[model samples]
Every structure is written in structure tokens, then in C-alpha cells.
Target: MSKQQMIPFQTTLFVKDTCLCLHAQRAARALARLFDEALKPHGLTNGQFSLMMSLNRPVPAGMADVAHLLAMDRTTLTAALKPLERRGLVIVAADEKDKRRKVLRLTPAGEVLLAAALPAWRETHATLDQRLPDIERLRADLRALS
Candidate 1:
């Protein structure tokens, strides 16, 4: 493209400064990094922590329910569960009542890990909440957007 026909560099600056999607993505990445670091000692990523947490319930959760709650597709959720399943931290099995459906539950080992990881997660969130001007509103806005 000729120099005269090229998009202006100022347009790039405008997007960097004002794009909501860009800002949200950057913030999400930053938050993920922080949680990843906090959960690192437990051999968990933020995504894994979230996935496991979604299965914490009185009954084994259906794969579809867990997938929806985690904002992931069933394929993605299934892939994410493999390492945890291999480690015996989680169990994925066919529902006895519905042979075609899969359900997920945390094993005793998973519960123990989650219990241990809770304090670290709590502490990190507390420190982060103190820094944010309005965490509740930010969360609500994010939920609405999602």
C-alpha cells in the first residue's frame, strides 16, 4: 500500500487508549496471571481451580452444567478434566440413571487440595479487592457483559 493510502498510526493509538474489548482482555489476562501465581504451589492453574470449584456440590454435577458454569464448551471442559482425572483429583463418569450423560465430582484428594488452596485464593482476592475502587460494580458489569 502507498504511504498516502496507509491507515494512520494515530488510529492505532486511539484503539490502544479507548477500546473496551482490548482493555477487558488485558485485565482478564492480568487477573489470570495473578491467580495462576497464587495457585502455582498447589500445582493448579487459575483455569483448573475454577473448573474444579465448579464441581463442588452435594451431588455430582452434570457435564453440561459444569461446562455452562465455567463458560466453556463440553469439549473444552472434557479436555480440561483430563489431568485432574489422571491425578485422581476428580472423577468423570457416566450417570447411572442416564447412560448417555457424564457427571463430574471432586474426589477426596481434590477436596483436600481445594481446601488448602482456598486460603491462598482468599488472601489474594482480599488484597486485590482492597486495591480496586469498586469491585462489586466491576463484577456486576463483567457479568452483564458476559
Candidate 2:
């Protein structure tokens, strides 16, 4: 390749050090692992826990709404629901008023497990919150980015 087509090694180093996406992804994975380990006894991953938590409302949440709240596309959210559905932890069905629309809800067993898992989730979050400086601000910034 010609020099014009080459990206300098220094540029790679700069991106490695300063890319927000890279940093955020690395942090996300690490945090997922931490929470995954904490939730293992409950047979839930961090993502699954969050998904179930999203469905813990009085009314079954619309699939699109849950997808938006979780920052996931419908297909990805549907794929993620497979294991939970298989375990009877969540129910996905067509909305009553709109047959074409889908909705989701946690089962009674899922609620019980979520209640049981709350302490571990709280403790992990508390530890992370204590370790991070100005976590609220960090969260706000992340929200803004999203």
C-alpha cells in the first residue's frame, strides 16, 4: 500500500488511548462480568437481570418500549428473551389491544428471583458507586451520550 493509504502507528495508539467507544465498551464488559458473577447463583446474567427488571411493572411492557429502554433493537431484545422465556422467567405475548404489537412481563417466579437477587445487585452497585468519583455526573454524561 502507498503511504497515503497507510494509517500511522501513532494514530492507532492515540485512538487506543482516547476513543470513548473503546473505553466505554471495556468498562461495560468489566462491569457485566462483575455483576454476572454476583448474580450467578440466581442463574442470571447482568443483561438478563436488567431485562427482567424492566418487565417488573404492573402492566406488561410493550416490546418496543422495553427495547428502547434497554437501548437494544427488537431483534436483539427478542433473541435475549429466549433463555428467560425457556426458564419461565419472562412471558412475551401479543398486546391485547393491538394484536400486532408485542409485550413482555416477568413471571411470579421471576419476581421472586429478582427480589432474592436485589441484595447482591444493590451491594455490587454500592461498591461501584463508592469507588467511582461523581458517579451521578458520570451517569448523566453517559446518558447524554446515549
Among these predicted structures, which one has the highest TM-score? Answer: 1
Cα displacement (Å) at residue 14, model 2 = 1.2
Please give the TM-score that candidate 2 achieves against the real structure.
0.93
lDDT per residue (tens digit) for residues 76-126 in model 2: 999999999999989999989999999999999999999999899999999
Off by over 4 Å in 2: 1-5
Model 1, TM vs. native: 0.95
The residue ranges of model 1 lying beyond 4 angstroms of the native Cα positions read 1-4
lDDT of each: 0.95, 0.95
Report the backbone clash tally of model 2.
Answer: 0
Lowest-sum lDDT 10-residue window in model 1: 1-10
Candidate 1 residue-wise lDDT, 20-129, digit = tens: 99999999999999999999999999999999899999999999999889889999999999999999999999999999999999999999999999898999999999
State the lDDT at 116 in candidate 1: 94
